[model samples]
Target chain A: MDELMEVLRRALPKVNWETDQALVDDGIIDSMDVVSVISEITDEYDIEIPSEEMEPENFNSVQAIYEMIQRLTEE
Target chain B: MQSIVEAVAAHARALPEKFCIADSRRELSYRGYWECISGYAAHLRDLGVGVGDRVVVRNGQNLDTVTAGLAIQLLGAVFVPVEKNAADTRILEIIEAVEACCYIAAKPMELSCPWEKLGDVLSFRDESADFETFPYPGGADTAEILFTTGTTGKSKGIELTHRNVVAVAENVIDGVEMKKDNVEVIPVPLSHSHGLRRYYGNMLNGSSVIILDGVIFYKKLFERMETFHATAMDLVPTALSALFRLSGDRLGDYRDQLEYVQLGSAPIPQQDREHLCRLLPNTRLYNFYGTTESGCSCILDFNAMKDKKNCIGRPTCNAHFIFTDEEGQKIEATEERPGFLACAGDMNMKGYYQSPQLNAETIRNGYIQTKDLSYMGEDGLIYMLGRQDDVIVTGGSKVAPDEIEDAAMQFPGIADCGCIPVDHPLLGKEPKLFVSMERGAAFDPAAIFQFLKDRLEAYKVPKQIEQMDEIPRTYNGKLQRKKLLELEAARAAERSES
Candidate 1:
């Protein structure tokens, strides 16, 4: 989780991807940011994040993103 | 007709029961739409709103918003629409800038009374009010004051006349091949000119419009389209890209029903364009290139010009474009020496609101010049090469960021990219690129540098390539190169501190 957060921090430099951060609702991450985050996460974790699974809930924070990756990996 | 409001009122009298505007929850017939406009206009009139007064209208994409806008115009007042969900501070700033007579919000705001509420206005509609006899200003009268997206304190209000709005709508109708029976689905912001003009044009042709708030509601959006049996839709590139992502391969299902799709306000990626073409093989896809100040200047028939996707096709409707050098000399269409793009026609704006200096600088001899640099190809199509301010002066040579960005987009693993000039001790300034890579792709700045080196001149190749999560853009999705520069500067400050 820390490693995932580190990756996000470096890629999305001005963003606060902490556990409490509301990435979408707070306007922290927009559609363009979502695109980049998805691409980076899938490549780094060797997981395929399908378009249907791309929802705001799954990516609202670093913790949320990490959990989503775990769920996709298990699937 | 002097204005769209008067024409729409006439249409209402002819066909009172025809559905003019519809959303998920409510629908307004032409008669009902006209009545609502009149009622609102009367209410505004009671509030001391009259001719030439600037009214700040902040409402999301909906039926009431459109009608309220029409009502304001009916009273000969200029409607200044701020983006829905804009912060109160931002709204206040714009209100101050325009010296708006009254502020109207879709929902309740923190501001006190005298600021009209849209919900209250909608509830007080006078169904018997006759709107046709209401005197509207002539063609040259200012109809709207559209504020283009800009950084704080630099927002320029574009004053568009009745003729300007109607001309752009007509240009869009012709360019997109819209018909009277066409049911156009509008999912973009109603505040902007593109979406507003598309609605106005359709209304002029007596066509029905379905308003969907956002593309985020994919299920509801598709359901609305199917329910309305929509034949056409208009959206900017960002919205279209998101739709493509959300729908994936399923977008092709509507190809038969959707006659055409208009995309503008930002550049569509070649990959996205090609994929969309495949998805809607029979549907006509257009790359509409125009400005808020200049309506529909150029429309590229992407279906026919598949080989020249980068080319913005010849001028549309009554518009005429010319490339002018620094000395204001018109450069002939010889496919060489790119220069500033200047436009002349009915589509051009009257001028910027309250800014005489800017009006003089931009509009010269009835020709409105844009900062965008372009060249007229031998094929007679216009090829844009980024903004004039985007040119990097390095080693006594000028390099356009569009060429570099386009070249970078072709390299594998890169999803989106932008290039900007960075100060250098040696060359004065050098080009540096910021890229947002494809998900799961490896970071290889060296590989990208080498790839660009192979294709471009040495000075054109970026000195540095940094991977970023996203590119800064305006609310309407225009690339904010100025914001990117600020971000780079902040990063440099952090680096020096470390």
Candidate 2:
């Protein structure tokens, strides 16, 4: 999860991650970015992010994306 | 009251034998054109179309379409012309939104409005022309309801009054220095301000208008231009670029005959303008800067292109422009800093029909906030940056898409490009470029990246590049960036699953 946050911080430095919701609503982190993020997450953590778990709501927030990666790895 | 009607009657009386509109099929003189419009006007009145009634006209660009427009105006009713080739859903949406009483379609088609065959309307050869003149609603009455894609969200009706239309026509004539003998080949969509203004402008000047079937077929367009001996023509950037590339040699044949080539609607790329000037050295090129809201704002002449390059030229007569900040305060022309472009003019539209929210956001006091960012140089020419909404901010740095796209297009093999923002974990956002290449050309993404890197700043370089078969465009040939973004998102999702 820390690794995921680190990668996210590198990719989106300007985003506060704690306060901003512009990623999903304003079409900043669209579905393509979701796939790329999931792929990068799996490679870094050595775990797979299932297709069903790729909903926009789950990956909308930084914390949510990290949690999803943890759940997928544990499963 | 009758003076407005007299304007049309005066044109008919003055130039009865003069060619009014010519299409592929036939040519109609001013006298014949008025007679047809009079018949259609009588037909519309019999069908209960009175003042303020919205009439939807759907037909290809032909003499009949021009007649339909004149007929609507002659009867003092609002003309809402839907693009003939518009998607059925889009057409229905417009009809439903406008609440049109009668729709004049070229053929029997399913539409929300009661579709009437154009043949049936025109076939009523009532030679007993009583010419029942209705009380002409001067400047205030809605002349046309032009539907422009709403920047606010949904498509809204732009209510243009008779005064607005006439003001625009006069502005085009004065700004372009249109002569009475200048024959203009109008190939733009009649639904748009470009087409309507050109048609009426030619009529106002007693000049001939050669209406092509549509603007899509470049070969046919050249043929028609030569056939009619067209001296002037108006084109959007895409059509102009396509014609420039397709008719490179053929254009030379008519180079001497052609007088002026007017471009508007979208930004004319610097390279494309240079190529056009090179091809037709004798012809003058003009770029018009205006919107459906304000009819004619600036006219960038051929000479201005050499020095100002992308500048939209000075404001036209009867129009004034000012750059405003976010807070609506005026910004002075200085060495640095560009501001939002605003217009104060007679050619401005009345307001969005039944849209108080949009009216409030767009028009404040007497000025229309164009939402287009621009700066005035020392030469007093206004250079438009891009739309305010099109600006992308990544890693605290704001980026304009036009600068990136313009730089990218300068590279070989690239035809058209659109830059959209993609979410980045560290950067907050990064530009994802979508490019369309010229036919029979192979694109190397690395070469493009290297080219962009050489031309632009490191931060402005596109993080990702996607090649598309063709760029999606609106009916008027303006790039649909939002649609491209959607396609990019969908493609990304599909790739993830694979």
lDDT of 1: 0.80
Q: For candidate 1 chain B, which ten residues in a row score worst on lDDT?
A: B105-114
Note the B-chain TM-score for every model: 0.92, 0.90
Model 1: docking quality category: incorrect
- What lDDT score is found at residue B485 in candidate 1? 87
Q: Candidate 1: give its CA RMSD in angstroms.
A: 6.3
lDDT of 2 by residue, B404-446 (tens): 8888888888888888888888998888898999877898898
Residue range with the least summed lDDT across 10 consecutive positions in model 2 chain B:
B1-10
True contacts kept of 1: 0.06
TM-score for chain A, prediction 2: 0.74
Model 1: residues with Cα > 4 Å off, grouped in runs = A1-75, B110-113, B131-133, B151-153, B393-398, B423-430, B450-460, B487-498
